[model samples]
Target: MKNKQWMSVLLGLTLGGFNFAAEAQTRPNIIFLMTDDQSIHSMGCYGNGDVQTPNLDRLATDGMIFDRHYATTAICMGSRATVMTGLLEYRSGTNFMHGHMQKSTWQKSYPVLLRQAGYRTAFAGKFGFDIQEVPGTKTLPVPSHDFDVWKGGEGQTSYSTKKNESMKEYADEYPHCTLSYGAFGRDFIKESAQTGQPFCLSISFKAPHLPRNADNRFNKLYKDKIFTKPDNFGRENGLHFAKQSHKTRGYNAFEDRDYDKDYNRVIAQYYRQVYGVDVAVGMIRDALKEAGIDQNTVILYTSDNGYFCGAHGFGLKALPYEEASRVPMIIYDPRHSNSGKGLRSATLTGNVDIAPTLLDLAGCSIPEGLDGRSMLSVYEKPTATIHESLPLINVWGVSASHALTVVTKDHKYINWSYAGENYEVTEELYDLNRDSLELVNMAQHPEAKETLKKMQKLYDGHVAHWGQQAVDYNSYQQFGMLFDRTKTWAEKEPFVVELDRASHQSVK
Candidate 1:
């Protein structure tokens, strides 16, 4: 009887060990999704009230949503570098929005680190850094990227008809699809999940971007809704840096546009592009579930930066305004100890935290080169905030000037340099709580003098850290990118306005 009882106990122990090994073999896969220039307020989850982002909203319902998240920089390359490297734009020195990436400086990006860790990694969609025209470009792969599978780069400004200039050499084996960016993303997710190996896949969406175009289906999604312009629309820039930045972008949200026609179409099209991206997210989530790994994959959805979208009378990105810098950052870790349903955290977060967060979650060593702290501890201890406050800085990308913005929990300060130097000569400051639209400037106000001084110190500290010694806070204004007649648009070749005295002469 004793021998029989011992035999039964040993068999039960053996079965339990087998089950544990199987569970251990199931390492979590990561599906990282990022959109270009999408505003946080544009999504339903973020309370846009109009934009239909059902997929992302669902993800929020299932996982955790981070409010008050920010992008380290408001440009494509800068933002991407921060997220991938877990470093600030200043730390990585890839602050420029579009340019060649120095491989030596940015080799420590998370994807490369994941590759080193034996995770099959793939990256797809708009690779925006190498922005200049290529020479008979057969493919658009960045010369420095270490992504094992790279299928990316929409060649033109328009998202709808982005001509596929070339496929990356590594992506040659995969069947290339030229459908809308959404469809391409959905297909990539479907294929990657079938690999049956633990993998890290990044789906970068390039939509709701300028020359904005959407698939025909989404074009009609919100065609009938009466879209309202931003509440802070047409806010004035009391700061010189902001004013010049506004002038450079031609901040005429409602002026040049024919309200009778273009306004509704633009809004509708923008939402459609957003909806298509949402649909892609849903497809990816569904694919994970269909592959029976939905409960094990860590899904993250966010944007590189926010778009002005008619806010502050501007349409494009690269500004220090909240509308341009605040992006949507959401992380859905299935194995997370935090709330599994509809969890919301207001702890300050940004692209800089992405790499460290993922690395910590993966049980990988966080590299010392990064500037961001892993949120793993934040997730465990919600009481402790990451930073007392964070500073935001925006230098010129194509031009030589500075637009510096400082964001606190309740206040925001901006100093614009039109000459790209001399701060005291020109600047703007606003109390966001009192003036959400920022129509009034409190910089020169006597009562706000102390606040301005403190903000100045913060801005100075960031500038020094970033190696922007040329910024003359006293007189910070200069022409960064000069217009050239050789770069004429095909649509504008017919008209010429030559300056004659104080007037213009029309060239016939």
Candidate 2:
């Protein structure tokens, strides 16, 4: 009887070990693909009749698409920082080109947590954050040691040049920087799969951002395509341009040339660059399948921030407009049985939610004090809502004109503050249900007074919750001068200076 009892115990232990191994094998591998300055309106699946994005369209068809995803800050560095740390710009202190993220904040980043949890991680392409080049400092704040593989760029990498260290290997193999990024991503996936561990690969593409350069092969992709101008293309509402100062307008690419000729050529080139990104997407997908990890991988695609293709007479982002703040978000999780393939979700999501959602999906412990909530519930149920409202910020360095916008499902409220020598502020409201394009501002409309008041309350609640305060131009200018490259090291004695105009260019 004692022998039989011992035999039963050994068999039970064996079964438990087998179950544990199976569970470990089933953990989903994650691949996050991010593009630079890509708007939702520029993609084929998002109703762009002119853009040719077959791979992105296929990814949408195989997964879920979000219609109302927004960036907390409509700029590259701020948005990328939000994605990495799961914290808004105000909380993370990584807003604009002003401050580097704190070391304590980097400890709680998703990649760092995932690496500690035994997942093999790789980061390829642009890690869009501004790091000040101090005279004696040997290192910046970038968390390079958190991943098993790290091939990233400092700022906006060139689209056509091989100057970036990360793209040197693939410079000759691929025609454009976008394709080189994809190739590196493919290699990382194959190498990680060989280790037999669940991997998280992040591919951030530096395409269609600035200089609008594309591979020569794609020059004919949109040659015959003549895009229609946006309804608010030419500043039909005089109040819109009134809010922008001359300096802000110059940074926004608002040329005095005719809209027809400029819009067609620039947008066509942008589309061509996007096409190169699409090709790279196809290559990466093929790599996953070739490595036999396709079924167990969750592929997510989004952009750092949206771009303005001549919307409201502006050609770049850094505005509170929908074209700049809203981005394309898609999640393709093949392991999810109830995902309802090709689902369209209108749940309000933002860049801040990416880190927590990824950590939650990876079965890792999400640290406390994260501003973003897990989006896994919304992915499971398409009708769910994550955030009732999100605050949009565009505090570009120490610039005179900055914007704070509160966006909800059906309305948007913007406050443009010129916090310079002369203080001025402008308010604008839009009822999105009636005016999706935001062509009409109802801030002064008598009938919409109650709606405007409600929006104000919501904005106040967000400001209180996030600890946001009015911009202190004096302090901002004093701190900003420390990192100014043009200034000598000895000039670091605290002094207030104008914002570096060269830093506000559109290339970034």
Candidate 3:
């Protein structure tokens, strides 16, 4: 390298040395890939000694791995909505039972903004939520016409490729949805590269999520493999958890999912399903190289949410615990000097930051009043911080599991306000720095009183924000009082009667 080039590289490595406008004529192509219900523990790059994720590991090596990335909402639909709009769940106003995303919000999403900015955009796999013209009006079809290419499906898209209408063409050759997404990515990359226009391809893979139906091609990969259990992985370790959390189905998932009866078999299959996603990642990376656009293209990879995988005796995501909320995040910008240095950042990031990050990379103006900020600084300098704290919300499923929590780098505070009959209002605190596995609840610890009070203040701020800014529709406004610590259980009782009645019976 020449002296001037070396100096330029050094300057680019500074905290705020972003090259936002150097290439006015050509912006890097962005490929955002997300998986469903994949835990950070499932990846080889995340220090899982038992998994095979060479492609993702290599990507981590070539880029920066964010160790503290969290899904603001640890469920599929809510997390996806947060990622799309750079808003928290109450503001996004879209989830399984809440409702559809408003057309106005969808218009301002990252994809629509990028498309409007004259970039080629494509989408494939499960489009988590649909669009509604207005709050409670008739729903519209998935916004396929907004993108240059559309292979996305609605609802829980099938693992069988042929069953998905848009992906049927690749069914014969790929057969399964995981590999079919890879082929779709390859084709999109090749076709986009030919057009000389910057492209953004977002592929949402349905692997490692439900119905286990992983590709049969890799059946022998982990056959009869006895997986190592996490330290906090059973009913005993979960005894310290709040009584309200125990009332939720997540607490009972250990037995329901047979993790207790068939530990080795269940885990092997879980990792096996993740393995298929790894293979598809390899396929897409190879396509990028073959298309000769790998250098100028940026790749952002993460999961919609992390799975419990028997952690804390829980099964799937939606809890505020680390295992269920913090997912793997990697950003690779080949044009930056920071590429290929095997870097890892512990900066606090959340799902809401994804949109702002992508929009910033495209040199598009970030919308005003976003809950997240651009991570370009964090990307330029790994130690740089983007968020002081982020919320981990769970309003889905049984009312007992519903929580409002806030997490800083070293501490997490969760509040379960569902107190009717047998349940009581509960508060749980964890010292993430000392007990990342959540082996102990520090909420009642005498020495931790000061820290607990501080976290409670932060939690209160989030609850206040929910009251002030949450959308008026979809029953979101009710949560303002329900989650308010100042509000007594008597004040909250009337709002939760129906939910309590329905959930109490459903869980049993």
Candidate 4:
């Protein structure tokens, strides 16, 4: 295990060094592959031991992997909005860009800019913002005219055998192609290549998200891999900062009733689902090569948000911890003449950089009023730091109180505010040099006062820049408007141990 990890580290370093040597001779076709509820810790290239991700790892070998990449807000709509717009979610006026898509004020998304720039823009999988007719949200496809090829959001069940079972009516809202959803995105790539037009394709996978219900072929693929539990699993709540809203209940946090076997079972399946996504990535990448456009394509692989797979004993997302906030960012620029090979960058970056970077790559002028800056220059110089300290912000799913955070190379600090005042103030300071697991929260410790103060000041600056707003996460918490009060998988049905055992034995 140590040897494997060392080898991966060496590969990452080699890739990082290659960043500056590459140059783009041509404007590349861009394929942006984003997954739902994926964690950086689950990929082989990102230091996961159990997950098989040859495709993404190959991309890392061929491009760049960002070590400190993250989502500004760790929720579906907000994160996606940030990635698409290269702006803070608060700035977009759609901080909690979920369910109510039609009513949200984000009618003008970043993809619209790409569309105007003469690129064939396409979107697949999940489009953020809840369209469910509710009190606080407006109904029917909240007016976002972004993307030329908008073909995703098949809901929870599509791509699985049960794709038509659970959310049959819901899936009907979006166009359902007979080709597996991944292929649909690749098909767009093929069409774009044929049309001789530059394309921006967002292939969003609803995998490794929930229920761990991947296609049977993928589900049956890695049934025997052992999943090691995270070191910080099953944490006591009071030691950390007090989380806002009811979302941090027993279900989201680690359950005392769960044993090692149950936890591993959930995680192993999640990794397997990721492997399936990786396979799709490989297929698309291979297609790009076959079409002879490999060298002229820029592929970006990332996720919507980080999910805690038994980390901090949490089953759901919505936390500021590294496990739930830090996501994997892989940028494979085949046209980059300097370091076309894998490059590892430790610079502080976020989804907010995505829009500007994409627009910049296409030679399109970035729109004014964007809080994010293009990192194309930094990509050429791997060690060049663009963001000295990046802001990480998130609001509660149940209420309006919001958390403002800033993460630098050395420390992390977060502040919770409610009702236009400091309702609950807590801070965390970690020396990434020593505590990778984040077991020690040194915010209140007198010995770490200076570091905490620095982080606090940075956090304050971010808060002042972004400002306070009645975001959706808070609205869901305080008003329950965006909150989906449905029973969970465990709540809806008892765990059938017999069925799992039978399947396991049969596979063995």
**Range of the 10 consecutive residues with the lowest summed lDDT in candidate 2:** 470-479
Model 3: residues with Cα > 4 Å off, grouped in runs: 1-25, 498-508
lDDT accuracy of residue 81 in candidate 3: 94
How far residue 232's Cα lies from its native spot in candidate 2, in Å, is 2.7
Model 4 per-residue lDDT tens digits across residues 1-508: 6997676666547655222112223456788888888989889998877678898898898888899887878877778767866767655534442233323334345567666656678876666554433334444652334567666553343653225432233334323322255566567777777766678887777777766565555556667666676677665532464445223542334563353337766777777778778877877887887788888888888988898766655656666678778899888776676455667988888888888888888888887767777777767988888788887766534333345667887777665443222333334577765786777878778999988877777765665554343343322222111111222323312222332333243211
Question: Which residue runs does candidate 2 get wrong by more than 4 Å?
Answer: 1-24, 130-142, 237-242, 245-252, 256-260, 338-340, 419-423, 468-508
Against the unseen true structure, what C-alpha lDDT does each candidate score? 0.62, 0.75, 0.88, 0.64
* Candidate number of the best TM-score: 3
Off by over 4 Å in 4: 1-26, 95-108, 130-137, 140-146, 154-157, 161-179, 236-253, 256-261, 400-402, 418-424, 468-508
Determine which window of 10 residues in candidate 4 has minimal summed lDDT.
476-485
Instruction: State the displacement of the C-alpha of residue 505, model 1, in Å, after optimal TM-score superposition.
Output: 29
Q: List the residue pairs that clash in candidate 3.
A: none
Q: Each candidate's root-mean-square deviation in Å?
A: 10.0, 6.7, 6.3, 13.9
lDDT of 1 at 80: 78
> Is 1 or 4 the stronger prediction by TM-score?
4
lDDT of 3 at 23: 34
Distance from true position, residue 290, model 4, in Å? 1.2
Candidate 2 total steric clashes: 0
For lDDT, candidate 3 versus 4, the one ahead is 3
TM-score of candidate 3 against the unseen true structure: 0.93
Clashes of each: 27, 0, 0, 33
